[model samples]
Target chain A: MASPQTKRQKSSKDVPYELIYWPGLPGRGEHIRLALEEAGAEYSDTAFSGDSAVQTVLGYISDTNLGDALNPPVLAPPILKHGELIINQTPNILLYLGQRLGLVGDKADEDAVFKVNELTLSALDGLSNEPHDCHHPIATGSYYEDQMDEAKKKSSDYIKNRLPKFLGYFERVLKGEASKSEWLYGSQLTYADLVLFQCVDGVKHAFPKAVARMGKSGDYENVFKLYRAVQERPNIKAYLASERRQKYGMGIYRHYPELDEE
Target chain B: MASPQTKRQKSSKDVPYELIYWPGLPGRGEHIRLALEEAGAEYSDTAFSGDSAVQTVLGYISDTNLGDALNPPVLAPPILKHGELIINQTPNILLYLGQRLGLVGDKADEDAVFKVNELTLSALDGLSNEPHDCHHPIATGSYYEDQMDEAKKKSSDYIKNRLPKFLGYFERVLKGEASKSEWLYGSQLTYADLVLFQCVDGVKHAFPKAVARMGKSGDYENVFKLYRAVQERPNIKAYLASERRQKYGMGIYRHYPELDEE
Candidate 1:
């Protein structure tokens, strides 16, 4: 394991990356944050800044908030601004950062890049988005309490069917020869590992009982091992303990006792 | 507008792209199909290839049925197999094809590729995924009729909020200086435009009345215009007219007349 000091030294310059997202909840921004931390990249987040930072985040999405002519308008936050480029979409941001931070793989291996992206997208589809939907099964705009009945049904279906399916898929991937035992792809840790770790963490928070049941079932041994491996990485371990690691709240992976089953 | 003959001439090989997706309905697969068709790339779809093809598709994801050691396992279809690389996820497949088919932009313009990818991801997030939830609000495994009450509520929220929010965002993007009065990015047609076209078409089919109202309101003129422009493209027009184009039937964008409002 690389020391935190050595990891920080590998990062170029000081605070080149600017992440504009809503403060408080770990949300989707945590996926990007984990990657940055794992790479020991020097970046600043608006979540730590004051209330006005929220406006700055909203400004990019607003039709009226025109700043740089070259910078394209984004639809939502978890927007990454580096130099003149401003872009959104969590997976897209990760792709860019993975390449820039040399976290993906060798630049020459385009096939490996696409494979890592495939893993990232699948994780987001199953773990992040589907889990979010379990609570807000009807509409994201509406309160989860308002759709409690529907959420209960969704959560049950998720725990029984979807959760195992996603976890099992990753477990298989980790067991594959490509994983090489330590990472999701190849020999080194890629951004996809960080993403999968965050996703698993989010699921654990959202459906503790379901995850615990799965853990006891012993179906996803590789998946749990991969999760532990990501957690124990020196830089990631430091970041997780630090105040910089925001606690999970009313974001993509919200914990509701009713939404979980033992 | 390039003739179908001219467009077909540009393709590298004879149907090297194999799209593995569910048969019958045009779901997320339509997004990938639109790109292949518009580019006049020769591609064969497993949907029409018979029952055994379904097994072949499932073989990639099934742990016991692993055929290729090199090909990474995929969770779901809309999986593309070209040469040795087999990959899934619509946006990821499109990103790969966009670069290979010269549908994105100049190879040197790395920034444009990311920007186009951003647009593609945003469309899938709002138009594709959200619209699918309108019918299966509670559980995706269950039928829409089983959750009719919840579907009605979800559909109403989608019509009132999500539909316009997404269409309007694209409208703004189309009106941006980079669009140049023709496409979503720059003066050329990218896969993002094809995706936007397919999404609008799906919305129109699913929520005719709501789309009619938005069309009559005269807000998303640019969106409507881009939709029309893509439909008029020579190769795409031919593809739309051909028997190869599958109709929307109980898929992502289902037409439940009760869900639409005038």
Candidate 2:
């Protein structure tokens, strides 16, 4: 049952990888933060305090030699430094960290993690797109107010249909996992649970009634419990206590109570 | 001066990796195609010819043994199988393929690949979202006809502004290459080149005028020329010549001349 490249560090494995993300708003950074905290991997959030590193990362993205697959690569956060590997993409980063941290469970556990990760990601994507839609309800190039009328309509559909459906799916998954009752997967606190918790947290912030009727999520009690569980982890507690974690803002989870209407 | 783990075929060289993607419509499959082509490794594209395999794959996504990481992760095509590892997500799949295919360049190259991948993907994201917009127009949740008025406005901006901006960036990168005039990185053809070609092809199908205005793309003439060159490659040519390449009806690119707006 040997997998490829399953080697351990022969050198000093003391230091964790450095994560370079924008210093503000947990927006996307929180996903990585949750995984790292859960892994308790020795890592530092470089530029989590100042704007200098954030600018540098963005700049490097446009400049090839400086290190950008493409400027802004358009999305840069949760950069994973595994020994030497620097991986990006929240799911990709989480998957890597999960495998190494043992947060990724057995075969079935891994599958659940991947499914939930993808599913939650779809919800997140839908949510982010909705935000953008609100701004450019009429067109992506125009100002929000110009498209305010259209935004009202798109935002209305999102509130009424998409939000509840996405949240409800999670509620169901969590409920289905009721037998396990504590984690998204089997027993342990895997990255999938962390990500799902983040999604629910983000959505709850963005849509209260939608998520509320989405139920107490009492059916998937363990999943909700795991959400709280992530916060309790020592490294997470420290990271949360630190200034690194960004609060949700207009970026990802804007508090638009009107959009969450039943 | 060698990078650690630079050696190949170190493990799990037994099972050849299988890439299951649509037969046609470059769409996201191009990302996977480029990664493998760059690696110069031999692989198979399953369900490439028959419709049944693709249907099975779609079904596979819902009922995955890998659970969440299962089939066609997130309604996109192009799935990769490496021994026990099955991955989806264009960027995630490409990253994994690049790692195995030996297409990932040096540290700086790796960083550039990631940034470019992210940026390019966001652009593609814009394209997909906009494509949906063409249908939805005024509101994302409403019927296409319902928002036809808004769809026209949104479509106009996407055509005139977004297309050029995105395509122009590619033009800049192609023209910005330091060495080769035929590829995106080093002296060799990287996955980026392949993706650009497919994107160009997709855009041409979706919006001919904007791409034509993109004109010669002399900036990254290599990237531009490489598009034609890669299309003529033995495998690609052969693939296109066959049935696995898919017809133009479904997926990312569609012929809505009205949306393109001459």
Model 2 spans with C-alpha error above 4 angstroms? A1-24, A40-124, A127-142, A168-181, A185-187, A217-223, A241-243, B1-58, B61-87, B95-123, B126-143, B168-181, B185-187, B190-192, B217-222
Off by over 4 Å in 1: A1-15, A66-68, A106-108, B1-15, B63-67
The lowest-lDDT stretch of 10 consecutive residues in candidate 1 chain A is A5-14
**Docking quality level of the chain pair in candidate 1:** acceptable
Q: Give the TM-score of candidate 1.
A: 0.92
Q: For model 2 chain A, where is the 10-residue window of minimal lDDT?
A: A65-74
- Cα lDDT of model 2 by residue, B95-188, tens digit: 5566556555444343445443444455455555566565575444455567767777777877777766665555555554332445555555
lDDT of 2: 0.58
Candidate 1 per-residue lDDT over residues B139-177, each given as its tens digit: 788888899899998999998988888888887787676
What is the per-residue lDDT of model 2 for residues A44-100, given as tens digits with 9 covering 90 to 100? Answer: 775554657777566534534322332222234556554544546665566555666
The 0-to-1 C-alpha lDDT of every candidate, in the order given, reads 0.85, 0.58
TM-score chain B for all models: 0.91, 0.73
